[model samples]
Target: MKPLDPRLLRRARGARVFLAASVLIGVASGVLIVVQAVLLAHGITGVVLRGSGVSGVALGLALVVAGRALLVWAQEVVAQRAAAAVKSTLRRQVLEHSLKLGPVWLSGERSSALTTLLTKGLDDLDPYFARYLPQLVLASTVPAGVIGWMATGDLIAAGTVLVTLPLIPIFMALIGWATQARSRRRQHALAVLAHHFADVVGGLTTLKLFGRAKAQESAVRRVTDQHRAASMGSLRLAFLSSFALELLASISVALVAVGVGLRLVDGKLGLETALMVLILAPEAYLPLRQVGLQFHASADGVAASEEVFRVLETPLPMRGDRTDVPDLRVSPLQLYDVTVRYTGRDEPALDGFDLELRPGEVVALTGPSGAGKSTALAVLLGFVEPERGVVVAGGSAADEFDPIEWRRQFAWVPQRPGLRLGSIADNVRLGRPTASDDEVRLALLTAGAGELALDKPVGEQGQLLSGGQQRRVALARALLTNAPVLLLDEPTAGLDPDAEAAVISGLRATGRTVLMVAHRPALIAAADRTVSVGARELVNA
Candidate 1:
């Protein structure tokens, strides 16, 4: 995990503006530090050493204090804005890149871990930008400003501050490096815990059926304990580091105070000059101490950003020029020697698979479990890319056209439908948002699901409906799209004889080119032609 990668600032224009504003605010705050310190010394000397009245300089001191307060408030505002811009930009970029990588890439990782990274992990970066970064700027500018002002009044006190200042950063660097390591460990622990919890919850029913639920309890507890220990270790290091920095700042300020007092007592320094040196000495160390404290607070965010940068740096998949494909309804859809191999697998999921679907014909793909039936559908839907072949519709290769526009011409229904919590009509509307009420009802009738009312509410994941009814609703959605091609992956799976008959009948009447994967004899019988996929070739079934 690198800290504050330059690519982050360069990629997000809004983040650059936020950082620029923070630096500008830090400069203004440094100017205020000098003015406020000098005015306070002047006012104190007038009443004590010069024997002048306090009322003369009272208004000037009050104005300077007010100006300092205003600057502090403005700095916080700028810091917050900068943090928001960076977080939002990073989140959007991560999501967009993940989408472009496609589901095959995402399915390899835990969904829970991805959720945690996008939500809480990126959110942790807030403190880094809003507090730690601004303090770092102040630490660089304010200390220099304060030390330079003191040198003009008392060179001895200025030299003492300059010498002791290096010690604070030296100690900070050693502690910060250790803390960063601990913070990274804690972040990793958190992601692992989240993934374990999510997996356990999703598989709880299976575990109970196997009488292994109790066994999972120990696994969960072990992970929870590890996360707790990591968190405690990070907190302990933060507290220890903060204490060390405070102690160093206090001792350095004390030395400057002692030296100034001796010089004034010896009559070598004027009362006003000694007072100014004493005031400016603490000011020089305050920014440095504050930066050390804030660094501890932002360690977790910095560690989390390391993962964010890793995801952002992932290379995107190659894409071709966006050209419109010719209409598929007038010509045939053909796969010529297509082959696909998944990551971390010895054999290709698809190997030299070839087939053709003519207009108005139903084609059924059949074979053993790993016969690449689903992979063929994926190739047509533009989800998976083949390493050694082309998918052609009409005359042009599908890869030459924009995948999104090409996919829009086809309707797809997976083996399992993902339904949201909504009314039946609302869920179907997702297929074609501009569909009218009559179109929705007609589509439902076309898919043999007209019995389900439009306004009927389906609970989460369509739990209210039977499995066959849910399949029908998914079919209705496919019909509602009014696409020229229909791609179904095991459409009649888990259906009773009556429900399966209704689905097969509806699919035959779709009046669109159909490409489906099926293992059942009844589904194969309904297709105009059946193509059986093997390890390396396609055979007529």
Candidate 2:
């Protein structure tokens, strides 16, 4: 990202306001700085060079100082608010765009990395907004104003500043190039550590079962150490860059002071003018030095913002603006010669796939594991756009209906249902939040989960329930929906014969149109008809 990425101002409203305010503050600060220096030089020259009282300059000096302090405080307040609003806006955009990209895109991404980016990663931007950016505005305004003021009094001092001012930024650019690389590496390390830790925790149970949990200690330690090293490396470089900037600025200020003092000694310049020039020289270099120092602090945030922008800029799949979807109960859902080819795969996931889902019929999609059974369901759910062909409903193309509205017509249960930390009733209520307790019980009973307690707590990802029980809960949730179509992805994959039979019974009881990805013989037998999905030629069983 550049010093001030225009994307931020375009995407976040707060940034535009912040920039305008910063400019005003920067200009005011510059004027106050020059005024303060002039007042101090006048007071000193009056008291030292001549018999004069302190009363004249005292009040004006105090007011100038107070005004400068107020500007600093105001800048701080504005920067903090801008940081918060920008982060909030970016986070919301990322989430909304992720949804538009759909599950297929997300399935290929690392959820842990994304979680870290949204949480810890973006938080690193606090320094960028609060300190670095405000200083950047000052750097642009204060130095120019200071030099221009000095020029009116002493051209030599102003010329020296003009000659050396570029050095600080030149050095900054060189060091910043290196710092940016390190910051990016540190950010990557943090993401990798987060991803690794989430994976370990997610698979901790299996690791313990295999007596390999203890063995993972070394791996975790290694990743943690890498993150630590990267962090320390970034900090060390930041310190070195700060030291270098300070050294360069100090040298530049000293040069101006030496020239001013020599000219004053020769009686070639007045004491008051010499003192004012001397004071303003350091002031000119101060903002530039601060910019160089704060750049290091904000590097991580700049790197993270790049990642956020990448996600925000991703093109959403083309969806229809129309909301008038055909009634599923009357109009058949048809996928005619639909072909879906995922990235990096030579063969299409589903090629020349044709299926028609009529009203109130349970159709089973059965084929080998890699045969795109789930992909077919994904297409129906509007999660994946077919590379070729279109899904037609009531003589209107599926793309003609708004994606969200089209999805609302179907109740979908993935192979692994995502259940949050809640009771069984709470999870089921997600399908229909306004459902009464009796309706919940009826749905659970129909899905063969009547034996399970409604108040039973399901841990994160439904860990508290067994695989079969989780599937039943998911099915019950689906059963509670008012959607006309129920799309189940192997709803009874791990169930015993009795449990499978109960699920089949539940399907028969629900009069909704059904499409299921089935592998087991029992589920296929239960379906009204089975269609094999792998081959180009559709085989009905």
Candidate 3:
């Protein structure tokens, strides 16, 4: 992204407002700076050349200095607030758009990377908004105003500033390119380290069981060393750039000072006018120098925001505006000639896959692993769009109904359920947040989890519960939804025979249109009919 990316203004309303306010503040600051310099120059001339009394000029000088300080404080306040607002807006948009993209797309992304981007990555933008951007605005406004004011006093100083000012930005651009590259490298290193650490933590138990936990020490050390090296490299470049900008600005200002001093020695210029020109010379170069320095601080943030924009710009699947979906209790659901090919896969996940689901019947999809049984469920749930076919519901295409509204018709139980850190009752209530305690208990009983207490705590991802217990809680949550259709993937896999029997009995009792992926003979036997998938043609048994 550029120093001032227009996409930011388009994506974040706060950025546009901040920009406008910064412009106004920058102009006001410039006016104050010029007035302060004029007063100081006059006071110095009177004291040294005319030997005039200091009473009048002293009060005005004090007021102008205080006003300038107040303006600086105001800029700080506005910049901080704007940074907070923009970060909040960007975070919300990224999260919302990720959900809209659905699980299939997210499956390909690293959760750790996304987490780091949302947290530490976006937080880096604070310096960009709070320091770099304000300086950038000042660089544009203050230089021109200072130069123009100087011109009215001494054209020689003004012309000298005009010729030297462009050099700062020119050097800034060249150095900025290198700084941005370093920043990007550092950011990438940080993300890689974060992803590796998360993976190690998540699978630490398995690693220890295999006696490979110790082996990861070297790997982690390697990644950490890489990140440290990148960070140091970026810091070195920042220091060098700051030094270079300071040197350039000092030389530029010294040139103006030299000429004014020489002319004053020759009696070619008034002392007051010479002092004013000299005082304002450094002011012209100050903003640009600060911009160069702050740019390094904001570089990481710029790189992070570019990644955020890429995600926000990704296109979502086509969904209709229609909210009036037909009732799943009576409507027939059908997938006609649907084909889905995932990236980097030679074979399509689903090819010419056709299926029909009738109302109030338990239909089992039995297929070998990698046969796209879960993919079929995803298609029906509107989580994946078929590349070459359409889903029909009650004689209307599925895409014709809004995806959110359409998903409301079915309760889904994936192979691995996501449970939060909460009580069993809290997790169950997720299916229907307003469900009463009794309703939750009943659902748990029906799903063969009646032995578990409602207030029992489940740690993150239900780690506190046994595998079978976690499955039952997920089943209970799905059962509590009271939707017209049930989509289950290996719902009975982790259950004991008795528990499986209880769950199958519950499904029969509910009489909802059920479609489940089943590998167990018991699950297949429980279905009213079974369809054998992955064959040249689907076979009904």
Please, what are the lDDT tens digits per residue for candidate 2 over residues 1-541? 3788899899999999999999999999999999999999999999998979988799999899899999999999999999999999999999999998887888877999899999988898899999999999999999999999999999999999999999998998899889889998999999999999999999999999999999999999999999999999999999998999999999999999999999999998999999999889989999989998899889999999988988888776678889999989777999999999998999999989989888998999988998999999989878888899889999999887889899889999999988989999999999999999999999999998899888999999999999999999999999898789999999998899998999899899888899999989999988887888977554555
TM-score per prediction, in order, is: 0.89, 0.97, 0.96
Q: Best-fitting candidate, measured by lDDT?
A: 2
lDDT of each: 0.84, 0.92, 0.91
Provide the lDDT at 183 for model 1.
Answer: 91
What does the lDDT come to for candidate 3?
A: 0.91
Error of 1 at 486 (Å): 2.3
* TM-score, predicted candidate 1 vs. hidden true structure: 0.89
Better of 1 and 3 by lDDT: 3
lDDT of 3 by residue, 15-126 (tens): 9998999999899999988998998998998899889988888899888888888878888898888889999999999999999887778888788999999999999999
Q: What residue runs in model 3 are displaced by over 4 Å at the alpha carbon?
A: 344-346
lDDT of 3 at 307: 85
Task: By TM-score, rank the candidates, best first.
Answer: 2, 3, 1
